[model samples]
Target: MTINETLIEKKFSNDLTEAELLEFKKLYETDDAFKQEVDFLKNVQRVSETEDDALFRNQLATYETEISPKKVFLNSKWIKPFSAIAAIFIITISISLFMNKDINNDSLFSSYFEPSKNVSAPIVRSEKDEHLTNRAFIAYSEADYQQATSLFQKAFEQTGNSELLLYEGNALLAMDKVTEAIEVFKTHLTYSDALTNRTHWYLALAYVKSDQLDKAKQELTIYIDSEEKFKKTEAKSLLKKLK
Candidate 1:
């Protein structure tokens, strides 16, 4: 039997060998084409549970009109007529659900949440120049998020620099402390600083990560409507996914 067939058979029977499990994980992670093929197979497997024959036929027909001459392949074999129709039907349903589902909040967050760079302070300060801001940014750059957040808060208190709140929030986000990150971003936005628009974008991402879809959409809309050109394209894409 083929490797894939063996894996599928064993997986369904709850008896995948350790070596097979390791092989499956390696292929899924390192091989993009193989991962996509596996995902397609999984989605097609779900098609068997679909009971609406009329809806399936209608969707399949619609997809057939859209890409009529293109051949569909499954399990390395060519299929036609109802078999091809089933493949296309599953693909259409998959696309439809992807565009409409709110269950992708975690995925959308992962896809779009990039940490803002350390524009607050340079990491190359003199050894004796031990300013709190520099130390905080150094901690952040080194991925010491717990120390970074604390130092950012302290530096903000001492210097009255609202920008530190932005990094503090970013540090919290890096730690996956979504609720703390949301509050920090919200607080940072209250100041009339240059980071206000950027904070809105980050805040929207925080809301999305927290599964607060309505707040995420609202913050995203605000960010999209702003003049901050940095993440506008990504914000628009994320907003569309939320819808």
Candidate 2:
């Protein structure tokens, strides 16, 4: 298969090798046709898994019957097989419908809001692990966001470690406390820590979750313009959607 078809298949299966992931990112960034095709496929996959799958399947059958025998070209580099033409036609229609609909901030936030891992304080399982910071991160790793948020606040207050605020913000965001997470991320930004860029990215997601489109756009722009590489591509995509 061509890079376009190979990457698209691997993407849906969550099985992209590191090199394939790099190729996917490059194509997604540089090739508009490839990017749109991947996005349309994403919509197709999403709709197929929803409660209206039966209805969507019936519609797909109708679309298939109506599609011409002409081959569907995904990009200059990739022409879909004849058997896949009907599926490609349905994907194109789905993309058109999605484009014509209003931007769903909630859906966008859900799609992109993955909490960063606990990099500030890596937890090791040990009987001697008695430190408050260790317990805080341990709680975080266990998905106990409530306790983790509380311990993070205390740890930051006790140690004056601003990075704890970043984790705290993440815990809050994971718990769906957007306003609290935004404040914690802002507080983290006030410090001259290396995590300043990361905090801003989280703050952007918090703004998006709260439907503060203006703030979300501003924060996303900052992340996209920054030297930080984390989520820069996703930030650009989200910013484009907001626009």
Q: Write the per-residue lDDT of candidate 1 for residues 141-179, one digit (tens) a residue.
A: 888999999999999999999988988999999899999
Q: Any idea how many clashes model 1 has? A: 0
**Roughly what TM-score does model 1 have, to 2 decimal places?**
0.58
Output the number of the TM-score-best candidate: 1
Please provide, for model 2 over 158-200, each residue's C-alpha lDDT reduced to its tens digit, 9 standing for 90 to 100: 9999889988999999998989999989988889787889887
Q: What stretches of model 2 exceed 4 Å from their correct place?
A: 1-103
Q: What's the TM-score of every candidate structure?
A: 0.58, 0.57
For every model shown, the clashing-pair count is 0, 0
Cand. 2 Cα-lDDT = 0.79
Which lDDT values do the candidates have, in the order given?
0.78, 0.79
Q: Output the lDDT of residue 123, model 2.
A: 82
